[model samples]
Target chain A: MPMNPSLLDNPKSDRIRRVADLANAKARRRSGRVLVEGPQSVREAVAHVPDAVSDLYVLSESEGADTEERSPTLAAIVDRAEQCDSIYIHRASEAVMHRISPNAQGIAAVVDMGALTSEESQVAWSDTPTIAAFWQVRDPGNAGAVIRAADAAGCDAVIFVDDCVDRFNPKVVRSTAGSLFHIPVLTMGADEMLAWCSAHGIAVVAADIYGTPGNAPRTLPDMLADRVAVGQSKAVLFGNEARGLPRQLLERVDRIVTIPIYGKAESLNLATSAAVMLFSLAMSSHMGRM
Target chain B: MPMNPSLLDNPKSDRIRRVADLANAKARRRSGRVLVEGPQSVREAVAHVPDAVSDLYVLSESEGADTEERSPTLAAIVDRAEQCDSIYIHRASEAVMHRISPNAQGIAAVVDMGALTSEESQVAWSDTPTIAAFWQVRDPGNAGAVIRAADAAGCDAVIFVDDCVDRFNPKVVRSTAGSLFHIPVLTMGADEMLAWCSAHGIAVVAADIYGTPGNAPRTLPDMLADRVAVGQSKAVLFGNEARGLPRQLLERVDRIVTIPIYGKAESLNLATSAAVMLFSLAMSSHMGRM
Candidate 1:
């Protein structure tokens, strides 16, 4: 799509307000649209999911020049968006861009929400897939951080089990950096997640400090030492931040593994635990092949 | 010390203002005190370093009943503070407590800065100790998260090398979630850090994705495979949030190791990288002992 010649100068315009409204859950659900803010997110959306992006907004130098003096980073993102014939590009003033989203660092994208949601049937699992699943993760930042961790660990997919913060929330999207576009993220009930894993021969390992009575949690090192078991296809389920996994959920999982704390700190936070556990398993699995 | 009989209802009183001023770096320097906010940090200070706490401020239920209906958690922290006869406990109104520090959840403490700073001479190194160090880490939250990660991984101590964020910053203290009191944290120049590691017969390892010319970085798993070398006393030094360690510093390290990115995400953030690397090394070292 060619760039829109007219610059978006009015911050109060209907188009700008509509773009900003996507930040709200109700607005997003009503319009089936989500705002992807910052250069990193916009660039990834354009590169990987170009067809999903309906509009690309870039900060212009002035009312006259739409493509002049942009930071190399922003210019590159805009250029990438131009290659996608489906993406409509618009140059906006600083105030207009700020109004669309305060976090947009010279660029933001309006994407179709339906295009980002992944179903179980759509997922292409590896021969021995590793999945990262979360239960009732409420914080946007924590949710995003874990997704990035999962992606970095090369997890095949992410499943948000039960109640979770909206994955499309701007803060969550911003926190994921660009990993949100790199991996498939699905939202499903806990039972469905467990059943899907079982059907696919993937074991469900719950990440918790305390296991149910009589089922003491295995230390991560102990789990890693079992190379064959660690290398097997699996889904790691993490609990909420304040309240960990419920006993019912723990009883249903195949196993419980906890990160051992060597010092006096009470426990690791959700995000840190997910990263440590996921990366540890990834490293162990990769090393097993060698 | 008995609790102060009178309630501190005035938010603008000199004593309250002085307590609040500890949040400012300049004020902290002049007074030699730091503000430890939230129940976790205050509780940890009282439990681990009681003598360092000069004053403990807690929110009161009302002007009449100083201690009635306080949350069990806050009441427990207050009880711990009371056992230390040197700690002066004061009850403040909700407005006064909020005025002191917005992040303080029912409790805050005024601690002597001198008590928290660990000099090179004072650190008691463990047998084959592991240390976590950062060079020019600028973010307050990142500094605190890394400190917590180091503590959790059983690092002997943490050294903030070169220019870094003030560890006493309330955000840093709060982000540690009480690990600030669990580990010894020191700030020093890069040369001093390197010299101290050399004097102690400890190897220095730099955590960077890209190593200098002619010296490619080793993957973390490969380093982990070398059990004998990894089990030795070593200090793992991380770089700044944006600009990684300079080539000069990277060249001085015994080894440069990078966490492998199995997926397309660019790289892990400072906190996540620290947790993964520190925990991986810790797990490897612990398993080696077994």
Candidate 2:
């Protein structure tokens, strides 16, 4: 890929405006493009899915100084993007870069939304794989954090069930801290997700502080102690930020497990709960193998 | 105590301005008070340390309506404050409440700063205590989230070692989700923190991905399997958001433990790392006892 000779100095240009508009859901859907802001996210997009990245915009040397004083961190990302034949590298003025995305440290990327979406068939589940699923996770930051947590736990894939934040939202991409490209994230309806898990021979475990009246919640440690179950393939499902899993959903899952709060904290937030639950299961499963 | 008869309709009143200014560190020091925003935090403050809460501000039920229609959640919190003789309940218009604190969900509180500080001597350490300490944690939200995590793990006390965000910051208090009232949070210099933990016969474990050269970090699961050692009293210290613990600090700690990342997510954020580390240790210790 060759770098564009012309410097993009106009922040109001239609090209730049369209790229900035990708931050909006309507713009993303209309253009079939998603903005990946910041060096971390852009770097990951280029490294893991270079074909998906259409353009890379980075802050250029001020006006016309002979010396290139770009920070090494961002320069490395741009260098990596340059290696991809499909990526078009463009230099933009600081103002233009800011207009593109204020959160972008020095670089941003425009990725194809179609290429980013992972079909259910694309997910290659490992033997005894663990999956992380969220139901109606409204907060963009929470959605991103859980994705990163799932990735760190080595989950086979992430499923955003029912009405949830769009995975391509710029804020969600920024919050994932580059983990978005490391794993497959799929969207599915509640019934479809449960049915898919059942068909894949994966047990559905609902993470809720309170289980249905008759089916009392099991403590995380109690579940962990049951090594046979903990080591099996399962999908740990989390609920919305304000309201936890509904009774109907709770009753349908194979098990309801809660992270025991030793102190007086009423409950854990969705992101924290997801990390604890996923990591605990991952560590226990790996340890069981050892 | 009865509710104040006159509804505070003035958002610009000196009283309201002073309370709102408590969001600033200098203002908090000058007024010798801290602002506890949101119904959850205010309720916890009233229930746990009523004597410290001097005033409670709640949204009024409109100008002159015969039927009071305040939210039940807010009304319940107000009722709890009413039982405390020292807490003065005052009704304010929505504008006044917004001016006091936009994040306050229909209620906020003014509490004495002196009462919130936990002297090292005041912390009631358990036989096998686990302390969560952070060094140079700059973000208010991360500071608050970690405190909540520490509380959920039933930590004996929280220590802010060296430079860190003020625990009294309104953003930090809001992020805690009321855990601030449930746990004792004490600030100390790095050296003082280490010395205090040593004096209390607690092991100093630094949570760092990279330990000092030749002193590789132990994985959390590996440490957990050592039931006897994990069951003993310890202080798990975390580092700044951007930087992990300094080599000098990492070298000084009795053990350097890192949470294993099974996938390509790179590293977990400070808040997530703290929750997983604290909760894992807490669970392991409890399971050991069982």
Model 1 spans > 4 angstroms off: none
TM-score of chain B of 1: 0.97
**Tens-digit lDDT track for model 2 on A107-164?**
9999998898888876777888899999999999999999999999999999999999
The TM-scores, chain A only, for the candidates as listed are 0.97, 0.97
Alpha-carbon deviation at A223 in model 2, angstroms? 0.7
TM-score of each: 0.98, 0.98
Return the lDDT, model 1, position A110.
97
DockQ values, each candidate: 0.67, 0.64
Q: Alpha carbon lDDT of residue A261, candidate 2?
A: 96
lDDT of each: 0.90, 0.90
Query: Lowest-scoring 10 consecutive residues by lDDT in candidate 1 chain A?
Result: A61-70
List clash counts for every candidate, in order.
0, 0
